[model samples]
Target: MDLKSYFNQLTTKERELQFGRKAADPLRHAFDVKRVVHAGMNGEMVPPPLAQKTWQDLMHQKVQGHPTQMAYFHIPFCKTKCLYCGFFQNGTDQAAEDAYIKRLIREIEMDAALPRLSGAPIQAVFIGGGTPTSLSPENAGRLLSTIQNCLPLANDYELTLEGRIHDLVPEKMDVWFKNGVNRMSLGVQSFNTEVRRAVGRLDDREEVLRRLQTLSSYNQCSVVIDLMYGLPLQTQEVWQDDVKTLVDSGIDGADLYQLDVFEQSDLHVYIQKGKLPPAATTQEQSAMFSFGKNYLEAQGYKRLSYCHWARNNRERSLYNTQARCGTHLFPFGCGAGGHVDGLSTMLERRLPAYQAAIDQGRKPLMFLMRQSPYAPLAEVIMGQMNQSRLDLQKLIRMEPRLKGLEFLGSLWEEYGLWQDNGYLYQLTEAGQFWQVNMTQTLLESVEHLLGGSSQIHQKKVAAQG
Candidate 1:
């Protein structure tokens, strides 16, 4: 059956859910709510019986052709939990951290000699966490040194240290630079002191700028930060000022994000109970998204991805862009996740299980997934949509059935979300704001069109009604 026939088979309500309910303000009102935090279709999880064998079999073989590759290291310790963060795993304790670092180094060593890892050049290395910067200089140094010694990093590798900016002191800065970290991605969700403190971010606005300046002054790495829109107390005025501050801060790049507050999260509860002001609605965030994009483009900042902007050649944001396109990522540290060959694995997030597994000379796997047959097509959808463009021709060439997806481009274009520029559909400012939604919907539609009916979930997040 053709895609249209498949789509037609769904009930009216399901069609509305899959495509959208058209509205005057399609960018916000077209969908009932944002569907997800990030966009991609689900893959079948590998059962426990086959998980270890899959890992061993994949690791035993050499990577055939050169593919863009990267590594992810998770540091699950944070000194203070930011109210809005979802990745926080554990609080920082000196003794726990010391032991964790030792275990992490051992984990790195375990994979060092494997031909699948050691034989190829790693394009990027991202050390992310509850707060990687929360690590003491000693632990940070130990981790960074081990990475340099263990991974076969590419000569032009982009090593990014991802964490909160509280550790921007000279001590941590020196450790990062000494170990060949060429990039740093710090979370500075807001430059509005009121907004920050309301959400448990310790540093005030002035201190944030000062520390960022300190890091940039080192001139050793591409210093990037994450700024969010639609937080409680982050009014349009405050949001504009945040953008202005970023331009003046002279940092290399930044990701201007629209905040997603889960209903179960502290931020959501606080606002609901009147402890904090309401966050911006989805429509309001759309306006903020347009303003930020326009302002950054006006300032000659390159739009590296939908939300990410680069001030110069310094911030490549390689790992983020490439990982979505099926780069082989070596996961390390507890709570880390990666994909190898066609399998995706998440290491044990629980410290005890992770330590026990590693101590027994086993990969600390929590779950392993075999990528669905649709993954390659989903990757194409995600990678292209992330850059605010989608090449229908590429999809059609990849699989003729994907031509049906073009109808989506047509509909979204009419909604003022995108434009046809010859061979590709370039997302408008509105489309970019709603990229995650569109990407998820399209991925599900692809499955429904080519296979069977699939459920598309619409979630209630902070910005959504």
Candidate 2:
């Protein structure tokens, strides 16, 4: 049978099972599920670029009054590429890595002088990458020092350094803490050694736990560890153990992400060639996510956001929260993505292009800038939904096009996906499981209502021109 018909049939069966005599209409649910699945299977959509003049205009307006909340630096070097990653990353070359840091610092200095960014006191700075910790201690220190010298950071600024377990040595952590980094986000996708090996992540489980213990001892910096579900060899027991261990390890926070096997990633190719096991089914993955959410909440960890849990207010994830809320994020380094004044920006993905731009005294290449009229509202909706709650009335007030979207609550309520408490709507357990899909469905519906079409408006940057 064709995919549409298959989904229709599947939805019908699900409705019968889910509600029996009280089964509501399943057509919309089926259509939404199909769209969600299709989107998940597709590759990342690169937004089209806007002209440099447009970017400059937006930056000018942004600087005049817009509050700068976050800044991000991307380090694109990794010790080894994980099987499931599709990020712009290269194998660690010490010389190339050092050179990249130098160029990054130069870019920072250049940005500091820009009239559009002058005197903007940033509340958060996120040093993320293929693996930021892959940088040597000296290079990392230099990068941090450059940021401190160039940018005006808020007094209570949040500085986060993203890394892997093996790279976060005690000495390196001390370096980070001393340099104003108050948070460390480690990618410990799984504590299962077998699962880690299968996905090209080489870390000893005992050593990882030991490092977490040591990291927890550093009261100056909060620790947030990432755990992944739906890996090839991940079992429910193993996934539960990962969550339990994280809670008991005294880490400040944990972020649970589902394994997303990109089509271009090694894991996808391995599965296609029958060289690796298939990922868990959607049902299995949903169960795993639900388990993690319930277990974490039960452990006194507050679900600050959909995927993020924190033991206290110190681990507020300021950068992520601000970025999601459509606050300005200044981008630095190759392959970093940010948004400012309604224009989504991305830096050059290639190291040579990024470095050459800096050498010529220009901002790194901006390959994409999404300046759609509907983008702001869309971002707000997506961001709020990602947080597992949405104030329908508030959204309608923000964008009148959302006036009739209240029916979405009814549909969601019928399917047990959301709770409508008459004042605001929040995602129920089922809705959180299908959050991404539901968010997409809502965005598409809003687009249709606004008579907006998803068209890429491409323009060449002045540097490229």
Highest lDDT, which number?
Answer: 1
lDDT of each: 0.86, 0.74
Model 2 alpha-carbon miss at residue 25, Å: 14
Q: What digit string (tens of lDDT, one per residue) describes model 2 on residues 71-93? A: 99999999888887767468999
Q: What's the true lDDT of residue 317 in model 1? A: 93
Q: Judged by lDDT against the true structure, how good is candidate 1?
A: 0.86
The TM-score values for the models, in the order shown, are 0.97, 0.86
In candidate 2 the C-alpha lDDT for residue 339 amounts to 74
Worst 10 residues of 2 by lDDT: 456-465
Cα lDDT tens digits, model 1, 105-168, are: 9999988888888888999999999888889999999999999998998999999998877888
Q: Residue 284 in candidate 2 has what lDDT? A: 68
Question: Which ranges in model 2 have alpha carbons more than 4 Å from their true place?
Answer: 1-50, 56-62, 66-68, 452-465
